[model samples]
Structure formats: C-alpha cells, structure tokens
Target chain A: MINKTINQKAWFMVLPVLALVAFNAIIPLMTVVNYSVQETFGDNLFFWEGLKWFEEVMRSERFHDALGRQLLFTLLILLIEVPLGVGIALTMPRQGIGVTICLVLMALPLLIPWNVVGAMWNIFALPDIGLLGKMLNGVGFDYNFTQNTFWAWATVVAMDVWHWTSLVVLLCYAGLRSIPDAYYQASKIDGATSWQVFRYIQLPKMKRVLTIALLLRLMDSFMIYTEPFVLTGGGPGNSTTFLSIDLVKVALGQFDLGPAAAMSIIYFLVVLLLCWVLYTLMMRNETN
Target chain B: MSSITLKSLRHSYLQNPQSEEDYALRKIDLTWRDGGAFALLGPSGCGKTTLLNLISGLLKPSEGQILFDDSDVTSLPPDQRNIAQVFQFPVVYDTMTVYDNLAFPLRNRKLPEAELDERVQRVAKMLSMQNQLKHRASGLTAADKQKISLGRGLVRSDVNVMMFDEPLTVIDPHLKWELRSQLMRLHQQVGFTMIYVTHDQTEALTFADEVVVMYEGQIVQIGTPEELFLKPRHTFVGHFIGSPGMNILPCDWNDGGAVFAGHQISLNGNLSNPASTSKLQLGIRPEFIRLASEGIPARIQRVDDVGRYRIIKAEVGGTSLNIYANEEVEIPSDSLHLDFDPDHTHVYCDGWIHEAKGQS
Candidate 1:
C-alpha cells in the first residue's frame, strides 16, 4: 500500500492570489451588483430599485441595435479573417529574411496604440484633406466616411481587419509549421494531391490554434470600444456603436449608472456564455 | 514488380561537397532485383535511410542516375516513381477513419467505388484491422497505426517497390516477431520488391532474404543471413551481427605466419597479406572458440550462465575475449588452452578480410 502525507502548507502559496482576486474581481463585481439593484443621484442618497434597470435595458431598442451591429461585425470579420488568414499564412515563406520582414509589417498596425490607430485612420479617411479621402474623391466616388453610414461601417470594419488579421496569420502559421515533415513525405509517396494534403494534413493540424484565434477574435470584437469610439465616436448615426461603446455611453455620457451596471453585467455574461458554447463545440470531438 | 538499379549514386546535403566525408551517401552502385526482400543493416548514422530515400525518389541524388527497370528516374519525384515508403513513425490522417485512411491513395487517383472498397477491405483484413475500420486513426495504438501505414503502402498494388525505414522500431519486442512474420507472409503473397532498413541485426537477419550491411556510408557486405554469419567480409559485419558479438584479437603476421600472443596459429588457407607494417587482426565468432588440450594460454576471468549456455569471459595477453560454451562443459579456474577453429578463424587486414589464396 502507498501512503501519501497530507500537506496543508501548499495553501500558503495560493493565499496571495486569493487576496488579489478578492481585492480586484470580487470587490468590483460586488460594487456592480450593488449599483445594478439601486439608484443614486448624489450625496450618498440611494433608493431601492430592484431589477428596474435590468428590465429597462432589456426592453430598450438601442441596446438590441448595438448587439445586432456587434454580432454582424463579428460574423463578417470571422468569415473573412479565418480563411483569409489561413490563405496568407499558407503563401507565407517558411524561412528566410522575408519572414521577419512580413511579420514586422503585419505587426505594425497591432503595435500602434488604439487611439493612434483611430486617429491615423480618421485623418487618412477625412473627406476634405486626408490622403485616402482625396484619392477616393479623385477616383470619382462619394467616400466621405464621417457623413456616410455605409462608408463609416466599412472604414471601421476595414480598420479592425487591418489591425487584427496578423494575429490570426501568426497563429495559423505556427500551427501550419508544427506539422512534421514525415506527413508530407508519406502523403507524397501515397500520391496525394496538394489540395488533399491541405485538407487532410494541414487543416486538421491547424484546428487547435485556429480555435484559439476564433475565440480571441470573437471576444475582442464583441467588447470593442477604443478604436471605433475614437474614429467615429459611435456616430455616423450610431451605425458603428457596439456593446462596449453603448455601455460606455450610458455610463459616462448620460451618467445612467444603474442601467450601465446592468448592461455591463449582461454583456459580460453574454461573452462568457458565447465563449463557453464555442469552446464546447470546438472541443467536443477531441476525446477518444 | 521492378528491378531497381542505382548507378554511382551519391548524395550530399552541402551545396559544394568537395570530399568523400561531405557526401551523406558514398558512391553506391548497386542493384536490387525484382521481388527481392532486402534489408539495409547498419548503425544510426550509417546512411541507410539516405539510400532508401534515394531509391524511393524522396531525395534526388547529387550525382549519377537511378533507373527502375531501364527507365532513368533520376529527377522524378516520389509520386511519379511509383513507389510506396513507410516512414519510421506511422503517418496517417488523424481526422480520418481507419477505412478512409486505407482508401486515401485510391481515392486520390479517382478509383472506382467498388474497387476502392475492395482494396481498402483487403488491406484492412490483411492487417487484421477490419473491426477498427470505423474508428478514428488517431485513437489507435502506435502498433496499429504503423500497420495502417503499411496497409496504405500495400493497398496500392500498382506501386513498383515498397520501402520500410525502421518500420518495427516502435513495436514491442514480443509483437515485433508477430508483425515481422506477418510482413514475410504478405511479401510472399504480394511478391513486390521490398527494401527494409534497420539498426537491429535480428530484424535484418529475420526479415531479409539478403542483408546489405552498411558502415560509414558504404556497403560492407551483401549476402544471405547464413553467409553473413559464416563469412563476414568486413570486421564491422563480424562485430555487428552476432549476439555478444565476435571476438577480434590484435595479431601479427611475420613471414606469412599468423602470430597471436607469441604463439603461431594455423588457419585454413594462406592470407593475401597487406603491408607487413600494416595492422592485422584475427576475427572469430565465440561459437568457434573451443577448449583445447594445448593452445594459446589464457586465464579465466568470469563466467555467465545464460540459461542454455555459459559465456566465459577470459583474458589472454592483455586482451579480453568471450567464449560461449555449453552448459555441460567444465569451466577452467586458473588457466585454459583456447583453440580457434581453423575453418572459421580468418585474418583481417585493416578491417577488410584478406582473402586466402585460391579461395573465393
């Protein structure tokens, strides 16, 4: 018989982390809960408003519209980024100086601060004087992004794609490179076509990393705020207002603290639930 | 069925290989006849895999040409060479089922449905994987996965040759015999040219009709298993083949007399000696060393009883030698006269066998 001694000393190693979480996550979360079920105007005056903010936020058309736009944006980019990232990664060189150059170029947009990225695009796409705006106007198209709803949405989506597709490319490239040379050799001996090799070998090997890329892109896109907020200020007729932007507007602009807290909680729960579903679906067939 | 011929084939990974050491595979001009079972037996860095890859067209030779039955396939790729190569590790599509894995090659070529099914079922049944046909390939054990790899190679009956690079390296010891016998039976049934590479002597001896022993990127000897044991052309073969290996003793040749430990030993025939100052050694298997009434004196060092026989480790003039004796024989304690069978003992000059006069 084997004997395992009971050791209570290991709990000391995790106490700091527990204290940190209590200070950081749990306390702030409790504050949000307190504000969600109560109302306060000033001077510590509070009134009990049980679930009123939650009910109002759920019924509001503005919240639904923001969620719909967020979903559309996420869906459109995912549909574009995944395959496009994979295609670009496949075409990327496996080795040499060109790899460093390509990676640096792709990472340039990601390295820029969110505000700077928004400002850069704003000035680049301004109707009167910006380079892209002047070029589009010179090309004889009405391409004023601040006034046109279609152009505003297009510019925001395009900016996000430009900013984040490199992440997908790098992840998928790592996944593609992880496959052993033996598989390619055996496939060659088996007379496998190039497409067959991609389908049966490369794609299955990349599935894990691609899943990670999808989850990251989905969560980040769902909660996007800084770039589009700076670019169009969720304007051009609220066309680019996503969930986080709407939450910020309600919290800071209107000072609707109770409704904002309720909306924030719901937004967090939606991201958690959607991410859980995506993870569960992706990992279902992994077990033996 | 095809007869593969390698004409002055050499390979080097370097861009400008100037010397013999730069070449991964030395000048290898050899022929593997149709439907022959051959094994490239060597150690880890002996260039056997390089030769196998060259034959399969996975690697093109840096110089010379490779011909498959008079067709120069020097620059052809592995796909067009019509050969199947089983890698050291099993390579199967992880997402596909066992049946689909077997059917992959046939489907790639757009074979008819009934024919593809028949081939897949036939190969699966050959590998005893019929029950696992629907299971995912990734869920199988290492041995079964390797069997699926072999099945994939064999399912395509049109492949002119099949190459195995250490196929049984991952198999359990007890199951290796089973799989080897299965492979032998399959070879007899299929009758396609097969080239197997391994560092294990037992695997090479058991699976191949002709074992091509390689050392340092060169072919040392190519012969049947019996010939490899009886008359190893190089000292490397003699040392690498037998269990507990052959005993190689440094000796001297003075006026055509083979002298060991200040005593003269007579062999079966005369040696075509190299330079008198050059090095020479007496190579003999432990089985041929016998207890004699009067021979070279040696002291008994240790004796190990390994079930059927006893391995007597002894020292003679600062050199250690192993002798495999029957369990019934009495072991000498202090000193013993060790005799070498004249018919089996031979002289090696600078590692190569010095062929006796008028003997092939």
Candidate 2:
C-alpha cells in the first residue's frame, strides 16, 4: 500500500460547539424527552407511561380546538399583514427626513414589550372609555371585547397585526432600496406602464425578502401566547385560547406535565414541518 | 432615420446656478446627422454622460431646445422621444429569459405577437445570441447580458436614435473586440444613427466616423480620427488622443524662429504669441521628433523599451521631453541632438491651437 498520513485532530475543533449545543439545546430537549416517556407521582417515585400521554393528548378535544384557533389566527394575520406591509413600504417616502420619520414611527410598535402591547390594547379597547371602543360605539356598533367571543378574537388578531406588520415593512423597504435606478430608467425607455413595472421589476426583486418575512411571521404567530394571555387571558369562552396558552394551562395550571410535554413536541414538529414546506415551495424557481 | 440637433443646451445640477462654472454641460450646440456613427470621447467628470442623458431625455436640459427632425422635443420624456439607451453596466431584467429581454421593447409597445417574435429573433441572430435566447439572463455571463441589452435596443425598428454610454466597461478584455466589431457590423447593416460614449481612445477611434472630444463640460474638438491624430484643434485633444500623448515645450519667440535651451528652431510660418494671461508653448507629437547628426544638443537621460519602439527620456532645458526612437536605432550614450518637424509643429495659446499664418 502506498504511504499516507492522516490527522484526526481536526475533530477537536467541533467539540466546543457540541458542548454548547448540549448545554443550551440538546440537554434540555433530552430532559423533556425523558419526562415525556415516564410519569412522576412523588419524590423518588416514577412510573413508565410509555405512549399513554401521546395517545391522550392526541385524543383530547381541547388540543384540537386550540390548534384550530391558532391556525386561523396565523392565516388571517398573514393575509392581512404581508400585503399591508408591502403597501405601506411602497407609499413610504424613499429618502430625506421623511424616510427617517416614517421608519422610526413604523418601528415604534415592534419595540414595545409583548405584555405591554397586550395591556395597552386591553385599555384601548375597553367598552366604556377606550378610544377604539368609544369610537366604535359612537359609530353605532356593539363592540365590547370582554363580553363577546367574536370581539375577543378580532381584538387579538388586530393586536398581532399592529405589533408585527412593521417587521415586514422594514424588510420589504430594505429590499426595495437595493434595486438600482437603472431598472426603472430602462423600463421607462421600454414604455412599461406603472403596473407592469411593479409586476415584473419590483415583485420579482422582492421575492426573497418577502419569503423571509412570511416565514418569520408564521413561526412567531404560531408560538404567540404572552400578548393574548395578557389581554383576553384565553377567555370569552376559550375563543382565543391558542396552542401556547392551552399548553401552559395543561402544564402549570392543571399539573399534567406528561401530556403537556407530549403536546409541546407535537407543536414544535408542526411549525418545523410547515416552515420547511413553505420555504421549499417559495424558493422553487431559483436556479441554485 | 432623423437628424438630432441640440440648440444652446445648458444644464446644472444645482437648484440655482450663479456662474458658468456651476453648469455641468456648458452651452453645447451640436448635431448628429441621420445615418451617422459618432462617439463622444472624454475623460471622467467631463459631462459626457450628462449630455447623453439630455439627448436620451433622461434629463431635461436647463436651457436648450432638443430637436429631432426639426421638431422641438425638449420637454418630452425618453419614451416619447423614441430614444433607446444602453448603460455602462448591462441593465437586463434578471427574471426574464434572453428572448423575453429582447422582446421587452416591442412587447411594451403592444406590437402584434408575430411581428414581435420575428424582430426579437432577428436581433438575437444578429448578435449571435439566438441559441442562448432560451436561457435565463441572470444565469448568463456579463458579456451575454450586455449582448442582450444591445439586442433590446436593436429589436425596436421605430426608435429615433440609439445611444450607448460606455457599454463595454464590464466586458472581458478578449470579448470587447468581438462586441465592438459586432456593433460596427450592425451599424453598417442597419444604417441607424448611433452615438457611443467612451473614455478609451481605441474604442472611440475604432467605432465612430466622427469623434466629439470633450473637456471640462464643453466639447473641445470634433473631427475624423486622422485629423485628430495629425492636427489637434485643442491642446487637450492633442494630449488625449494618442499613445504617450503629444509633447509640449516652453520657448522664447523671435521674428522667424523660436529658441529653447540655446538652440534656434525655425518656424514654417509667421507665428506670434497671444497677449492674454495664458501661457504659450510649442506642441509636437513624440513621433515627429527625431535624432539627427546636427540639431539642438541635449543630454540623454534614460531609455524605456516598449517592444516596437524605445522611448528616450532626455533633458534639454529645464523640462523633460519624451522622444520615440526606432527599435533598430543604436543608442548614443552621452551626447544627442534632436530635430523637430517644422511643418507638423504648432504653437498653442491658452490651451488651444494657434494657426500658423502661412497654413490653414
């Protein structure tokens, strides 16, 4: 055999990253994995639950209802925010002092704490004295979020859109600015109408950024709990009790750790699966 | 086909221009004849792009009337002016295929589908890009994208004028010659009025029938390549148009000859100095200076071999001068005498050529 020299020491460079992941993500995940397979009754006493908790959570109607509500909220907000964000970005002034002003104002909502956002909306939609409530009542509509299921759902959806749409706007605005002036000039010379320019030039250029915005909004909306928990507290007959709020109720409130852990794994897998499918579909046209 | 005229064209990027120096294009009045090939040759920051944009209707001139076939079109936009322009970097739609890119102009005009397809195929074949028309433009090389931009300009038969603003700046070195010759062949075949703007002398001299040389926001000279090489109308043209540019030397003038460094050089005609505050000097190309048996004595300084010719740097008076020696010529170590061609030499006053009284 021909002589060959090989060094196995390069594998050491990955040990540090492996250690960090073990502490930060893998170890915690394995703890949940352990708790998911067994039942704990008291100190130093355990029983093998096997697949019992998974079966129970899958058969529960509460889980199904919460999952349904979560899906509807995610779909509705995405439908509203992505297009509304892009429209606002299009109308925003391209440069000068106006750009700075609009960007700062758009960013104001995203910077507030989630609970604070929920609390602020809680007061702002109060039936008696809240500005929105008073305006709606003044316009002859019955609009009390605390007492009606439909109003609770609407208020929660509205709150998420107001809080998250600016993230999409900033991303889209950055994408629009990177396009060179030559594209517009060339299209002008080619006699393209404004609609044609937007359809061909602007939309195609914005596809990548828009994909990222969509994925981020989808994942965050799926895991949303703090804002709705603070505002509606999963109330008005459980109309807005999304998956996270339901998970917290079963885990901490009802003391059902095994079922909660099983549900958590299922929820994480759903988000991961959906994001992978959506990203693959959106990036289908790119050559690479 | 239509001739274009720019009348009293002036432009300033400033909101309020107070003086002539504030204008980017300072009062240019010129014409491009129908069915002519012209090049705007200038260095950077010379308002060449500004003038091209004005003609293409990208920028309205602050003060001028832009005329196409004697119609006033100063206020019109680029589409209304029927102008087509290719930028320095190729501006192709990345999402479109090469076929669709070529068909863009015609499609925008709502041409019949059959006619549009025919025109796109014709231009693609002319540019030798017919086979690659099915490929995406973003996936192609820079040269291929630029060919598509050129094809887009050629696809429209109704364009009043076609302009190129340094279109080959991004092309590979070997590909530049091929693209230039392709453009030349297209010009000869189509006979469309073309305006090419470039800072490189070779591209300008090879591409155009007439070269418009510019300097500092104003056009300094317009002539054939031969005329620009032999007799430059402006000192900047003489310095800018040739390899190793023209050499200029200061001298003391007498009635019939000039003296520099204790040598008397005879003049071919009666020439005198101008009385303006501008300096006057003798301008001669490096090719016209020769080493002879008896002439102005000078100390040979250094020699540089440039393959075909040896450039001899010699010091005569207080100035350094460059002279081209034939490759086969032997070097004289310490002593050298240089001769000037009196017929080709001219005096420049204030950066412009002063005509010799005896010649045109």
Candidate 3:
C-alpha cells in the first residue's frame, strides 16, 4: 500500500482548489438540479413537477434543432481544421529564425479574444467598407453575409477556421518537433518516399496530439456561443443558432425558467456523453 | 555488389572555410571494398558519424565526390543511394507486427507475398526473432525492437550497402556481445557490403574487418584491428584504440635510442626517418610494460583488480603509466621498476610514427 501520510499532505495543498470548485461549480450545479425538478412563479411559490419538464424537453423540436446544429458545426470544424492545420504545420520550417517567425504568426490569431475575433470578422465581411468584402466584390462576386443564409453560414465557418486552425497547427508543430532526428535518418535510409514517411511515421507519431486537438476543437465548437452570436445573431431564420445560443435564448430571452432549466441539464449531459465517448476512444487506441 | 569510395571529401557547417580550422570533415579520401565489414571508429564529435552520413547520402559534402562502384553518387539523396541504415535508437513501426515491420520495405517494392514471407522469415530467424513474428512491435523490449529494426534493414537483399549508426547503443551490456556476434554471423551469411559506425573501441575492433579511425574530421588511420593496435599511424589513434589506451611519454631522441626523464632505453631497431625528426615521444602499450627487478624506477600509486587481470597504475619520473598484469602477479608495496618491450615500442615524431632508416 502507498504511504497515507505522504498523500495526506497533498490534500492540504488541494483543499483551497476543492473549496473554490465547490463554490463556483457544485453550488451552481445543485441550483440547476433543484430548478430542474421544481416549478416556480414570480412570488417564489414552488410546485413539485418532477420529470415533467424533462419529458417536455425530450419532445421539443427546438431542443432537437439546436442539438443538431451543435453536432454538425463540431463535425464541420474537425473535418476542416485537422487537415488544414497539419498541412500548414508540415510546410513550416524545422529550424532556424524562420521557424520562430512562423510560430509567432500562428500564435497571433489564438491570442485575440474570441469575442474580438467575432467582431473583427463581422466588420471584415460587411460587403461595403470591409477589405475582404470589397475584394470579393472587386472580383465580380455577389457576397452579402448578413442577408444571405448560405453566405452567413459560410462566413461563420470560415471565421471559425481562421480563429481555431492556428491552435491545431501549434499543437501538431510541437508534436512534430518532439520526434527524434534519428527517426528521420532511419526513414531516409529505408528509402521511404515522402508520402510513405508521412503516412507510416508522421501520422502514427502525431496520434496523441491529434486526439487532444480533436477533443478540444470538438468541445469548443459544440459549446461555441460568442462568435456566432455576435457574427450572425443566429439571423436569417436561425441559420446558425447553435445549442448554447438556443439555451441562452430560452433561459434569459423567453424567460421560461422550467423548460430552460431542463434544457440546460440535458445540454450538459449531451456534452458530457460526447466528451466521455471521445476520451474513451482515444485512450483505448493509445493503450493498444 | 558495390564498393563505396570517397574522393577528396570535405565538409564544413560554415559556408566558407577560410582555413584548415573551419572544416568539420577535412579532405578525406578512402574506399570500402565490396562486401567488406567496415567500421568507422572514434570518440564523440570526431566526425565518425558525419562520414557515415556522407556515405549514406544523408549529408552532402562541401567538396569531393562519393562513388559507388565507380558511379558518382555524391549529390544523390539517401533514398536514391539504395542503402539500409539502422540508427542508434530502435526505429520500428510500433503499430505493426514484427513480421509486417520486416516486410514493409519488400511490400513497398511490390514483391510477391511468398517472396516477402520467405525473406522476412529468413531475416527474423537470423536475428532470433522468429517466435515474436506474430506479436506487435509496441509490446517488445527495446532490444527486441532494435532487432526488428536490424531485420528490416537486412531483409532487403537488393540494397547496395547497409549502414549501422551505433545500432547497439540502447542494448543492455550483457546483450551487446551476443548481438555483435549475431551481426557478424549475419554478415557472413549474407555477404552484403556494410559500414558500421561507433565510438566504442571493443565493438569496432571485434566487429569490423577494416577499422577506420577518425579524429577531428580526418581519417587518421584505416586498417585491421591488429594493425590499429600494433601500428597506430597517429598519436590520437595510439591514445584511442586500446583498453585504458596506450601510454605516451615524452622523450628526447639521440643516435642509438630515446631517453625519458634521464633514463635511456635501448632501441630494438634503428630509426627509419632519423634526420627528419623535430619533437619525439615514445609510445607503448600497458600490456608491453613489464614490472621487473631492475629497469626504469617507478612509484606505485594504485592497483585495480579487474576479474581476470589487475591493472597497476604507477608514476615514473612524474608521468603516469598503467600496466596490465595477470591477477596472480603480486605487486610490491613501495616502488617498482618498469621495462619496455623494445619490439612492441614505437617512436613517434611530429604526431606520426617514424620508421627505421632504409625500411620504408
């Protein structure tokens, strides 16, 4: 058995964090749980309506649409980001001053706040004064993101790719850098073509880091609120109203407390289930 | 089927080499005979691995040409050179089975399944890895993984040459000997041209038919193990090749013999290049230094009891020297006399050994 006294000291160090987590997370979670089961009115009257709100949410089309949007956005984000990021990373230099310059440029996009990213892209795609919009028009293209549903969706997806592909690039670059020079030497000696080297060596070696990037991108894309909220306002007949935006709309916009609280709980469970599945699959592959 | 030759090879990390000081590999000219087991041996940063990389076509030389069987291949990439290399660390496809790992190159070349299986099984049996064929490479020990790497390199029989860059570094000490012997056996069976690079003297000496000793980006000497030990062409080679290394003592040369710290030792033969000497020194192996009743007086410092033999370290005229003797020999407590075997001793001048006059 491990020495209990050594571990006892660790609890002392972790106590403050535990208390902070309990105050910030557990307390709010308990409140959500209480609200999930109880119905309330303006006079603070509570009526026990256990599982009724949950049943109603389970049958709601709005909940289904939001969940579907969230899943599709996450899938789209992963499909675009991973390949684009890996390509950019592979094209970057292995060493010298060029590598440092490339790393700093890639990191610049990530340092900008998410809300600012949304605002910046919103202005940049305005179709009249914005540089990208003017350029697109100059090329004799009809582009009005705010008015067109397809254009609005394209703008959001493109903006997300610009903001998040950098993250994947940085992670993969680090993974690539950590590979020993000896492996490259071995590959060279084996007469491996460029594609063979990338397929058999680089891909397998980048597995763990790719899994991490995939999980982070999936979770963030699923829960994304600020960018789409600010960029499109879920406009053009809810073309981009993701789950988080819809949840907020119900909780604060419509103020239907019981249904919104129930939806929030279900939202949390969906994210948890997806994250658990992703983690399990990644860990199983790593172990084998 | 091919012999590799380096013609006036020179390299430097700096773009322009202003002088002799700027080169990493100075104008080296050498050749490896076809189907020869050759080794480039030296201490760390002595340009042994650099020369190996140049031969393997991983590094392009700043000057000179590399020819394979008289075909100029200096500018070719490693893939175009048709050579197999095993690195210092094990580099195997971790997700593939041992059999698949060995068969990857053959499969890439579009060989038939029957031929691939035959070659893989043959190489695996040579490496004593036949039983691990079905198991994934990820679960094996480091040595076993290294064996798979070796098998991968050896399985392709059509390659012009095979190069090993310190391949046994990760192996356990006890297992190194067995692996070295197995490599020798494999070479004998296959008769492929091989160039082994290492810093370990024992591995180089025991494994290679021709050992090229390198120092400071230059080939100091290239010979068999016996020639390297018995006739080191440079002082660095003298200091590098032996166990505990050869003893080098500064001496003044006269007409008949050399004098060290006022003690005159008679010469076994006349000096070859007697008139051309500037600075001279005496070089002798510790194995040739005998502890005797009367000779050069020495102060005994320490004795190390290695299993089969004892190493006696002593100071003679303020210069430290080591003597290896049988464990049965009892050392005297206070002081001892050292005698140099004249036939085994060499006279070095200006960092090069001098042959007796009229002998060359």
Docking level of model 3: medium
Identify the CAPRI category of the predicted complex in candidate 1.
medium
TM-score of 2: 0.94
TM-score of chain B of 2: 0.96
Q: Residue B304 CA error for candidate 3 (Å)?
A: 1.7
Expressed as tens digits, the lDDT of each residue in B1-360 for candidate 3 is 699889999998898889987988988999899999999998899888888888888888999999999899999988778888888989988778899899987887788999899989988888888899999888898889888888887888778898898999999999998888888988998899999999999999898999999988889899999999988888889999898889998988666778998898776767644454477888999999998999999998999888899889999889999999998777899799989998888888887887786653
**Tens digits of per-residue lDDT for model 2, B1-360:** 689899999999998999999999998989989989999999999999999999988888899899999899899988988888888988888888899999988988899999999998899889998899898888999888888877888998887888999999999999999889998999999988999999999999999999999999999998999989888988899999888888888866655566666677766767765654667777888889899888987788899999999999888877888888999888799779889998778777778887766766
Model 2 chain A: lowest-lDDT 10 consecutive positions: A37-46
Order the candidate numbers by TM-score, best to worst: 3, 2, 1
- Model 3: lDDT to the true structure: 0.88
List ranges where model 2 is wrong by over 4 Å. Answer: A1-16, B256-262, B357-360
Residue ranges of candidate 1 with Cα displaced over 4 Å: A1-13, A96-112, A123-134
Interface RMSD of each: 0.9, 1.0, 1.5
- C-alpha lDDT score of every prediction, in listed order: 0.90, 0.89, 0.88
Better of 2 and 3 by lDDT: 2
For candidate 2, the per-residue lDDT at A4 reads 78
Q: iRMS for model 1?
A: 0.9
